[model samples]
Target: MTVATARAHPNIALVKYWGKADAASNLPATGSLSMTLDIFPTTTTVRIVDRDLDRVVFNGAEREGTVRDRVVRFLDHVRLLAGREDRAEVITENTVPSAAGLASSASGFAALAQAASTAYGLALDDRSLSRLARRGSGSAARSVIPRFAVWHAGSDEQSFAEPVQAPPIEMVIATVDAREKAVSSRDAMQRTAMTSPFYPAWVTSTAQTLESALEACRSGDLERLGRITETNALRMHAAIQGSDPSIRYLTPRSWAIFDAVAQLRGEGVLAWATADAGPNVCVISPPEHTAAVAERIGALADVVIARPGPGVRLQETDA
Candidate 1:
């Protein structure tokens, strides 16, 4: 096969997915909606050829272990679907920091899915591609689309692929800490799912949160969306507290910054914060208020603000 390339977006969850209903399938334990970011994403190139070697390179290094497993699984799925078993060479690069609690896995795996499917001449639709990506990482499923996308909770593959109708919405991500963390997303999710008693409550509340958030987005009510997201993140952390041996993602600095954002909201600044599996906080505000939010957030130590941006797309070398 000829060379093929694809770029996948990185998504930040408004309603978080903290566990898995089906670990092997990478099914979500809860429903979620995410906004894909423009600044950070993954770009991949895949070539299928009659080579004796199967190789994968990521960010100038040869990948191994779970990373290799994810690539192999994606390629194997592509081969199975397209009826080709040619040895493949894969190259991937990420604009986002890896393992820093950002959604690198979502972008990386989605890029792999897109590249592999393209290389193998597969005509898989978005839902089919999403299901394939989901097997690699749960959140990766939502990264397959642009703008705002939702992943529905269901019993089986067909049921789980159901899409939610939502309009495009703006999101701003603030990078508080970019260094890689000790815990991996997979490990964190499994630990919390097995140990957290509040996991049930997290799952039950997602539907309501997602419904309200979508409605808020549709009506251009940034305040409503921000409120739902902030509450959803708090609920996710509550599950972590319920875990045996209880873990928390919050740092002292994180709380300080969060409190600062809360203070701003109290001052009628229209600012709100949400977090993923890490200490970094993502804040949402209107385009007009984005600069104000960023300026306020930047006052806190070591915080950087990313402004409103588009979904993932191919990188133009000239631009």
Candidate 2:
């Protein structure tokens, strides 16, 4: 028997990944930039067992359904890579809420990929491990990279995440609604891609936006970076709203938070707001203003202040 455990941090995309280029390979339609957060990480342990079926426990509960299926499917791929037929027993503990657009899957799959590959005796490199993690969650690729990372949009073999240099910035995440979103990001992205007229524009403009954002990061221009992050996020949500049925993840509370950020900006505060595929909002600011931003947003909802975090790391291994 072999056992391994890994921990990974969830990332908030500054330049969002709202759609997939190739659904089968889970490739992003366009490149994205993100900062892996230090708070609310997920830890996963993988153990090879002789049983035919894999067992999965999440947050101390017996996990079944799509969540469990995703873990098992990832394990199956790991087994295939290692040329081992043994099933796995997966134990996951997440500080972030699952299916809530908080990038829970990003950290979850990153830890799984690391732990499962180690336990299966696959000495995969960082890029290979990122590619494998991408199979489980698209943003999981970025979580495999330390601190700020960029996920390149490319072929299955070419697409992966690499660390990027950025100035010191902090995030204030407001959990407006922590429950599972009404529509999954997968379903919502597909619908937006197929039906929204703005998708083409989004795809075309995202590449340019990413270039500008990267330049902002390189130059340590917090104002430029924050502007790009807030605008790009709003643009992605605009594409989603243009879908045939109109999928809306941002709620009134989310709007209120955005308004507060705008208000802070009007008052000479360097704060910018962004969100994933859910109702929660994240405000990015310099470390000096993180406390004030969090305190202001905290009045509206629960706030978690986060800084840039490290990549996935193995905690233990036994053979």
Candidate 3:
């Protein structure tokens, strides 16, 4: 097959996904809903090659060790599905910060899944592609659907992510800290599942939040959606904090941004904040006040305003 390329945008969860029910399967313990952001996308291209092992290059640098191993392992899933034995040459460029809780892996793996499958002549539809992407990163499943998505916690066949009935909302991401976190999201999630005292409560709360988020999306209730996003994110972090060692991702700057958002909301600006696995804060607000919200949070951190974006899609090369 000829070369194939795909692009996917990072997403922030409204109903957070914290634990894995099955580590080996990468099955989320609870469902999640997320909004795809227009900024910070990962574009991936794949080409089948006559090589003994898969080669992965990220942002012009050849990856080695664990990163390369992980990419190859994920590629195996694509190869098996496409009935191809040939290795692949994979190159990815990510606008999102790596390991910074910005959902880079979500967009990265989603793009890779689409590009690799297309390169291998696999005709998997969006649902099947979402399932395949989840094997690499759980959040990637939601990234396969545009705008908003809800990932269900069923078996492989039933646990696919689909588009939710939510309209687009303006988003402002406060880049508080772009550096990689001390503990990766995967490690933190596993630890929380194993040792967090509030793990059960988090799971239950996330499920309820998912239902509410879906409804808010359908009804275009930005206020309710913003509230759910922040609450769900805080609860997810609480579970991490309740773990044995207690992983902390949010920093003082992150807190400041949250406080600013809260103050803005108090002023009736509709600003709300949610953090992922890093210190960076994502704000959900209306388009009209996005500039003001960004200006308010800009004092604490760099800001980027974005909106809902499209999902994983393959494109032909100019060659």
Candidate 4:
């Protein structure tokens, strides 16, 4: 028997990945750039055992249902890659709020990919490991890389994440609601792509936005980076709203936070807001302005200040 433990941090996308190119392969429809946050990491430990079915213990409870099914499927993929059929005992924990648009799945699957592959005796490099993580969650690919990372949109072989150079920044997370969202991002994205008239325009525009955002990162222009981040997030939500059923992730409180962020900028603060497929808003600001940003946003919602964080890493291994 073998066991391994790994940890990874959740990332907030600067240029969001809103849809899928291929559903079966779980390939993203657009490229994305993100900064792995220093807060709310997930740790997972995988232990190979002599059993027919994989079992999962999440946050100290034996999990069954969709969460357990997802973990088991991910482990099954790892087993296939390693050419092994042994079941595993998977124990995972997260500090991040799950299914609330805070990207808890990104860190969770990243840590799982690292621990399961190692415990299953698969000697994979970072890129291959990132590809493996993507099979669990597309954003997990970026979480496998440190600090600023970008996930490419292409064929399975070409679509993976890699580290990129960027100017230093901090994120102030305003948690308006930490509970699980009503609709999963996977379901929302698929509905948007298939039904929304704005979906095609979103895909094309995001590709262009990603390029400009990448240039902003390279040139050390935080203002340009922040502007692109806010615009891209708004555009993503617009596409979601255009869906036939009108998927709404951001609520009144979320927009209230955005309004406050805009007011801060009006007062000469370099602050900008971005949100994922959830109601919580993350305000990105320069290092010097992080304290003020956090303080102001804290008045409205619970706040967590974060900086760039490391990628997935093995904490322990035993055989």
lDDT of 4: 0.93
Q: What is the TM-score of each predicted model, taking all chains together?
A: 0.90, 0.98, 0.97, 0.98
lDDT over C-alpha atoms for residue 233 of model 4: 98
Q: Report clash pairs, candidate 2.
A: none
Better of 2 and 3 by lDDT: 2
Note the Cα lDDT for every prediction shown: 0.74, 0.93, 0.89, 0.93
Off by over 4 Å in 3: none
Residue-level lDDT of model 1, residues 22-104, one tens digit each, is: 88777776678877776676888887767876788999899888778778887887788888878798888889888877789
lDDT of 2 by residue, 102-198 (tens): 9999999999999999999999899999999999999999999989999999999889999999988999999999999989999999999999999
Candidates 1 and 2, the one with greater TM-score: 2
